[model samples]
Target: MMDVEVIENSNKCARCNYCRVCPIYTVEGWESASPRGKLYTIKSLVNGEIDVDARVVKELFKCTTCGSCEVICQVEIPLINLWENFRAHLNSKGYILPVHKKLREKTFREWNPYGESREKRADWFKDLKNLTSTNSDLLYFAGCTASYRTLSIARDTVELFNKTGLDFNYAGVDEYCCGSPFLRTGQRDLAQKLFLKNYKKWKEMGIRRIVTSCAGCYRTIAKDYPKIAEKLDYDFDFEVLHTVQILDEIVDEIDFEDVDVKATYHDPCHLGRHMGVYEEPRRVIEKMGIELIEMEKNRENAFCCGAGGGVKSQFKELALAIGELRVKEALNTNADYLISCCPFCKLHISQSLNNFDKNINVLDIVEVVIRTLNK
Candidate 1:
């Protein structure tokens, strides 16, 4: 049975097509691709007008859940939550997407989402002798991508943290997926389980504050955790912060060497819009003494990199295409680097740049900050 909250909230949409006009669907140009269509289908299922078949399920899965529709919705409906509830409902009924199901299995079996062992999580930080302290109040939750795929980010973040004289510690093998992917994909039960595990571990470790380089993890930990804690009665005493926020706070303490580069920033969906963190990253960029060019569509109106909401895993080509569009936006700025605070955004946009014959550089905000810091 669908939760009463889900049923009532999902039915609240008045079928207005404001969400349909999103740039993503506009660029893709399909009715089924619009948020209104997805919501309508979900509403029909709740009203017993349609069955939860593979086709219906696929329609729900198509969304990146970028929350663009929610921002433009006249009724202020929680479109992403509705989609997540629909996903959870579908999953409960034995209708799970093959890609998401496989990824979930891997996440459950191996603490990391990439089916890698947990011990290797901190292997990337092996050479950082400056990161030896565990008693520091600052805890760096490198997320899955920085921990595994973009190990350089992990190293650079540590180097920057030390260079700025901030005592930082990592969750190391104890860090798991931030449950953002699972939550975004409608695996709420799995997300809750991972949340409880991570929350409890962090609490016990006496971590008073947490920071993550991944926008997805930042959103989940900073925003979603409090909600989950209320539901699960888990008491969280720590403050969750993004690396950009921390770096911005400490920007005055560091002086940048003259490194001339024109850069544009890509606002990760979760970090910028979902979490209202638009200024801190831009502040970091401006403070770096670099030429910060704005993308035509930036801030809340920014386009998604398409890898969000498990789209990268399920619809690789679509994700890449969306990423390519974002790359073009950066290239249009004539920027040397596309500085994004999210690791996943960096990964997708960097891949798009490489694959699409673009010379634009993609960088994480920490990398940029670290490079600017006196070595």
Candidate 2:
């Protein structure tokens, strides 16, 4: 039998071209790249009008899962979930992309998609003593990207937590990947295992509030985990928060020295459209006394940085092309820095800026706060 959700969501597409404003569609310029076009493809495949092929796989997986198309869908179809369900369906039939398969393998082996050693996961802040006690109720989940690739964001977040006298526990070496990559790439079984592991660990540790610096991690934990928990018949009771949410709540309590820089914020797809966390990060930037400029596309309508949904891993050229467009928009603001809440976004956007030979600093919001505090 065909996947009912895929067929239903695809049939719901009005084809009014609203989802044509998508970032991938902008770069690829093919109807197949547009969300509308993909929906048609999905319906045709599910109805047996078309067979599963490489072109079909590419067109489907090319999406960034940014939720922009979902925002524009007139019929209010849940596009993100549909995409994941279809991808999961495809994976079960052995249509998984090679890189995405490797990603799953790495995550299973190292507990992170980056293939970094699990023992070294907490090396970034293991020496920062007295700030993170395992006995604390608040857990700081400095996700895989922040812990492994963007070490400074993790350090800065820990510093901010310490400065604010916020007692939190770091899962340290025991922290597994929150399973964002697995879910996005259609490894549902792997994602469920990760959810169970993390959820049970938190429950056993008496964790009440979970905080993360990466937007992907925040979205996965705060939004995706609960759904998986319900499916698995587990009770999820933890309060998940992004670092900006916590920082926003404590902003007035800190002494922030003015940092003289004009910066524009890029809304990470996971944080902005997926989770409706548009203003908190912006409000925090404003609290630092830095001039925050608006991009041509900002908040709900913001273009993706092209790092999500396993696009960056599988379609490198396509991902960079999309990233270049967003970086150009950041350059148009002529700000001294481009600020974003996600380390993954910073990594991709910075790469795009370099490829275009443009000079502009990319910093996470926590990095900005730490800079102001020291100055």
Top of the candidates by TM-score:
2
TM value for model 2: 0.97
What are the clash counts of all predictions, listed in order? 0, 0
lDDT of 1 by residue, 70-145 (tens): 8888888777777777777777888888899899999999776688888788788776774664677678898999
Ten-residue stretch with the least lDDT total in model 2: 126-135
Q: What's the TM for model 1?
A: 0.95
Q: Which residue segments of model 2 deviate by more than 4 Å?
A: 129-134
Clashing pairs in 2: none
The C-alpha RMSD in Å for every predicted model, in order, reads: 1.7, 1.3
Where does the lowest 10-residue lDDT sum fall in candidate 1?
A: 20-29
TM-score of each: 0.95, 0.97
Q: Against the unseen true structure, what C-alpha lDDT does each candidate score?
A: 0.83, 0.89
In model 1, what is the error at residue 99, expressed in angstroms?
A: 0.9
lDDT, residue 145, candidate 1: 95
